[model samples]
Target: MRRTAAALGATIMLSACAWSNAGLPASADETTEDARDSDVILNMFQWSWTSVAEECGSTIGPAGFGYVQVSPPQEEIQGTEWWTSYQPVSYQIEGKMGTREEFAEMVQKCDEAGVGVIADAVINHTTGADTGAGTGTAGSSYALDDFPGIYGPEHFNDCREDISDYTDRDNVQNCRLSSLQDLATGSEEVQDTLAAYMNDLLDMGVEGFRIDAAKHMPAEDLAAIKSKLSDPDVYWVQEVIGAAGEPIQPSEYTGTGDVHEFDYGRQLKSAFGGSIAGLDSIAEGKLDSEDAGVFVDNHDTERNGETLNYKDGDTYTLANDFMLAYDYGRPSVYTGYTFEDFDAGAPGSTATEVGDASCGAEEWTCTQRLPEIQGMVAFHNAVAGTEVTDWWDDGDNNIAFGRGEKGFAALNNTEGEVTNTYRSSLPAGTYCNMAAGTDCTETVTVAEDGSFEAVVPAKGAVAIDVEHME
Candidate 1:
């Protein structure tokens, strides 16, 4: 790590303390319990275990992220496409990402770096029936209804046809999704098998699991499966994409763990595309803050147009910055490969291997390393536990707000520069423009009244906090 443990701790604790001067910054010594933890999870989508481990020490740990969400590590159907990561054939800890030994090493290294590793658990289904007989990444031969000693036709749900009705909860839970054979999640044997697979990962230092296709299984079944875990208290974030008229909702599974708030990203898309000033009222459509896991974008939403992607350019960065700065659900920042087509794989991916992440602009989006994104990691921590105050906006694309007296930010999504006098809750000082880095040449001066005039660039932002100053 570039910074010592002391330095990282101090940087993260900057704004997570109690304030007295209305919005005055906390002292460096205020290392409260809240300061030690930040709900920042970097979704290293499609990144190899080696790449994720390397990044944990160098970037993720130093950036103040508490966890790294990786692709499914279990053995999957051999393929070059990105979605293949979701197709599980065995729980052997061998996928295109890495081998079992490499996976264990990544967990240890990331743990030493103070970053927890969360696996994407695909317990809802196995390989698609149409995929036919094929060998998995670990050389395990898999047929649609037969996975050697692991599973057979008896373990699958009786609903053999594709899911045709989402409103009917039985079909959605029992039928196959996209011809992928659904598991009999309710059976005692099936739940035991799933629990054993997850226990193996937990034994290897995996801190949590992202329940892939959670909506396809009943909430009771998921709760029962989790109860069988070695540590049922371990984090579990389920992927329940809540639709308005759909019978299943993300709220139904909160008893087991957190649910990804799809509405948060969808609302971000709507607000950022129109008037970002409306963000102050964004809670109207979202799940309860604590139960929700929020992200600017994810693997599915990026391809499906449900949220913004790297292709959206500067607007995408601004949205991510907003996600970190705002007090909402546990925030996860996503970084993934660059592709012209939806089905394309990461740079050098083959049937049994994927290349290391290069983090270049033209190839991998590497959102975690962007100045506007990484710098905000500190800003988010600095302003933790503070409420949004001193809100100001043009009722359009330009908006500015403060997190009590700890920090402040102004976002402008217009084409040209939007210069304005913004209100803040900070004390008088020359603070660093965190849209740049802490060692940045650009700076902002706050008067005694906590107001400053600055030019927020086109589709850009200007952010400052007590902890990040010139």
Candidate 2:
């Protein structure tokens, strides 16, 4: 999702009353009620509204996943490319995912199923193409920087150009990202428009938002816009990619909301790739657990080959298992369609509409359906807020840990199975290995003295939580 810059010589144009209410709720506690208690969020990338609704009723809700981050729901540029969803044609709740009616229905059903919907918002830019005329998926017509009644050329940045330098803060914030038209967020009209769009979603029962390309906008401008939002409690997780020497850092955006921990995925990739012993260092990262939304990989990282995706087979699953079991950040699990071409859209469908998702068919990898992963989700929920204790490592590829008497996990990354006896925090009892679900024959018996013997299979994990105790 990195964007290259071109030039920036224009000053941000703003109206006299651009700043609205300045004292906005900036704490995580101010987020939606569902998000406040959630431990994990599932990123169902590119899944249609109906598909997400079905999964919520069938799998995610029942499995205890807190929320599901759906694809951009707004009307977007008509194209078969996946990135087309990132190019907003209008704020209308109509796009390849489904119609506004269908989206509303999906939200209602998901809410009934005890699952919250977090919309992926593409407010940083509109259509990047210079084509003068086109129709969006929702039948909205547009020409150049004009989005009919929603936005005009004046609402966009005067630069009218792509970002030129990543090292410069002004260029990164003001310039267009990969030719995408940059919005003048400092303008009261732009802030009011974006706030209206977001508030509409909130009014329709949306729980939160994942602000796409948040780093491309100035932090104070983002804060001002957020302040104008009607739902002050809506959860916000910004996509702020920070690296060494980059002037725009994630810390700058933390005041707005939690930022994605990109380094978490990078470190997980390195740990799961060969150095499992290094997993212990994850808690020592610069970002605090309370301020990060962590995941092993995202749609962009998977496409860029920066992090391990479902294509890595068991190794990828193991990484997810570790993320769910470890207590650090609010974990997110990602599942999407697999494709040979990075630019290819989801399976089945055309430029105007996306068909229903057929999980496990035509390169669609529904990793969330895996029993092991589902059990891990339960493990995370069962041990929520519990401190990680009883950390033990074989000083190699084998590791074991307990979560304040609520859960225990042992993972072996080596090529061979490893068995070891360790002290458990759980009360003396027989527990089913959640990794195998209720049908699992393997069970761990903890002694009264809080000791148990575990045999972790090669490249596999054994997880047992209090809820699954037999």
Question: Which candidate gets the maximum lDDT versus the true structure?
Answer: 1
- The TM-score leader among the candidates is 2
Where is model 1 poorest over a 10-residue stretch in terms of lDDT? 19-28
- Could you give candidate 2's per-residue lDDT for residues 1-470 as a string of tens digits? 11111100011121112312112123322333324245578999999999999998998888888788999988888988999999988877778999888899998888888788889999888888565578888777777777766678898888877788999988988888988889999998888778877777776778778999999999998899888776554578999998899998988888867899899998888888877876777968557777888899999999998899988888898889999888887788999998889999988769988888977585788888888888888888788768789898877788888999899988888878888887878999888887755455779898999888888877888888888877
Give stretches of model 2 more than 4 Å off. Answer: 1-37, 360-362, 438-440
Error of 1 at 148 (Å): 1.4
lDDT of 1 by residue, 1-470 (tens): 12222332233223222111111112211233433355678999899999999999998888787788999987788889998988887777777898778889998898778788889999999999998998888777889798776778999999999999989999999999999989999998888878877877777788788899999999999999988877777777899999889999888998978899999999999888888988988777677777888888999999999999888989999998888888778788998988878998888999988989887546988888887787888898889878889888888898888989999998898899988998787899999888875466689998999888898899988989999886
lDDT of each: 0.83, 0.81
- Tell me how far the alpha carbon of residue 298 in candidate 1 is from the true structure, in angstroms, after superposition: 0.8
- Residue 450 CA error for candidate 1 (Å)? 1.9
Tell me the spans in candidate 1 whose CA falls farther than 4 Å from its real position: 1-36
What's the C-alpha lDDT at position 434 in model 1? 86
